[model samples]
Target chain A: MEVINIQGTDDTPNVILDKNNNKFEISGRSLPEDVNMFYEPIMDWIDGYAEAPNEKTEFNFKLEYFNTASSKIILDILLKFEEIVESGHDVKIKWHYHEEEEDMLEAGEEYADIVEIPFEYEAYTD
Target chain B: MENSHENHSFLDFAYQLYRTMKTNEISLVYEGEVTQDITKTFTSLTEKSLAKSEESNAVQRKVFNVMVECLQNISKHADALSEEEDERRGIVMVSKGDDCYNIITGNVIKNGKIPGLKENLEQVNSLDKKGLSDLYKKQMKEGRISDKGGAGLGLIDIAKKTGSELSYQFKKISDEVSFFILTSTIRRNN
Candidate 1:
């Protein structure tokens, strides 16, 4: 699987999906004016990756902030991973949020509640 | 002798009240050259308002998201209201009340857009929470980016976050521009 990397802006987040290393990372602020355009390819890549087997799939989300629309799309991506896990693929999600931001931590918890993927949350000072 | 009983401090008393009211309502107004710079000020004001309310994290996030969308809506679509050439200018005010926070944004709208803006607000006012969520999800899926504006999700997002109906008015300023005032309130969760 080829890697995909997109830069973040004031509105969108950077998405890095390293298929070869089995590590996926999405970080930065996400408040896109048109959220679907920003998130569509990330979703598509995850969908395709689900079909192929990897040794381990680790998805890390380090988001400073994202709008509600982007939040829903992120949920959709997590749900897809849940399905992949159900199909017996080893998958996990690491949610990194700012230490002071309880909102981001709660958001991660909300997604974890709905999906079956093992979600681990870590806090950073920066 | 009867004229001597007339009140002499009427203007002074009224001026005192005016000062008190002005103090209670904090105003942070900005007039800038860049559209993006103007948006940053608005965004910071919104965050400060939300923090003052001390709402839960979820509610605060919702408010912030709606705020971003609304300001963007104004930046991209509102008619120029200031002397800045080729730059959009509008007013966004956040005032604290006893039990609610008031967010008021005023901008100039071109004559033709009045109907569409009115229609969207009317539709948004009619939806319940669940319905608005479903509608927002649907719009996110179908709404496309255009040169004109965003996914048209600004009003819906504001309505959903505020849990209050959007209030707006269109007043004729001239043949070319109309004043559009949009007000949304977030009630304190008890």
Candidate 2:
């Protein structure tokens, strides 16, 4: 699969899905006005990867802020990863938050609670 | 002379509105078409302004998230007046009090829609934090996104992030429509 690299905008996140390196990372603020239009491509990419995922797939989310619409899409992304894990690949999700962002931390926990994936928390002092 | 006088009065009215907003602790207020570009610019400005005075990035983020949701709500659901269906007829305001930040948004709606709007809001207001969390998770799994790409969790997210009950009202503008006002508050200390 070819790598998908999307640059971050003020209202959307940067998405980097590197098939060769086996790294999938999404970061920055994502509150796109049209949530579906913004997330549809990423979902499509994941749909393709789920059929034949890497042996060890790692995903990282470092969102500073996301609206409710983006929140649902984030969950959809994680649920797709569950398929990758179900196919026998080891999957790990790293949820990052600033030291003072308790809400972000709690948000990660909420997703972890609902999904059947292990989530690691990394806090930045900034 | 008449045109110059009209311009001067318009300026005077704007200046008075600015003074009134400042007196009420409002840091930002925007009334115009709630387009995507406006939503982005408004949210960014609000984020930068909140970051300057608040210490916790968490609170700042929460505030920003709530503001985005409300502004987008305006853009998506605000009733267009007529033929052209312009995304106007909306107002968004932000005020910082000593203890909290208030994000208030108002948009016109067909009068008949008030009942459904009130019911959804009341249902949201009835839930506690845990209940809201559970409801949000349930709605997320439903996968029934609105035409505007909303997940039907706008009110729930606002309640969860702010740790405060939502307050709203409907001001009747005519027999067929009204302007809905929604106010969400985020605390300075958590």
Best by DockQ: 2
lDDT per residue as tens, model 1, B1-190: 4444345466667678668658767444443332545655566666786678657655565556656766777777778653465666677766657776676777888888888888889999999977887777677555655554366667887887678999888889988779898888877563
Q: Which digits, one per residue and each the tens of the lDDT, describe model 2 over residues B92-149?
A: 8899888888999999998888898898899889999888888888888885678877
Off by over 4 Å in 1: A1-14, A32-64, A68-126, B1-22, B31-34, B45-56, B81-85
Q: What overall lDDT goes with each candidate model?
A: 0.73, 0.87
Q: Candidates' interface RMSDs, in order?
A: 4.7, 1.1
How is the predicted docking of candidate 1 categorized under the CAPRI scheme?
Answer: incorrect
Error of 2 at B88 (Å): 3.9
List per-candidate RMSD values in Å. 7.6, 2.0
Models 1 onward score TM values of 0.67, 0.93
lDDT of 1 at A91: 88
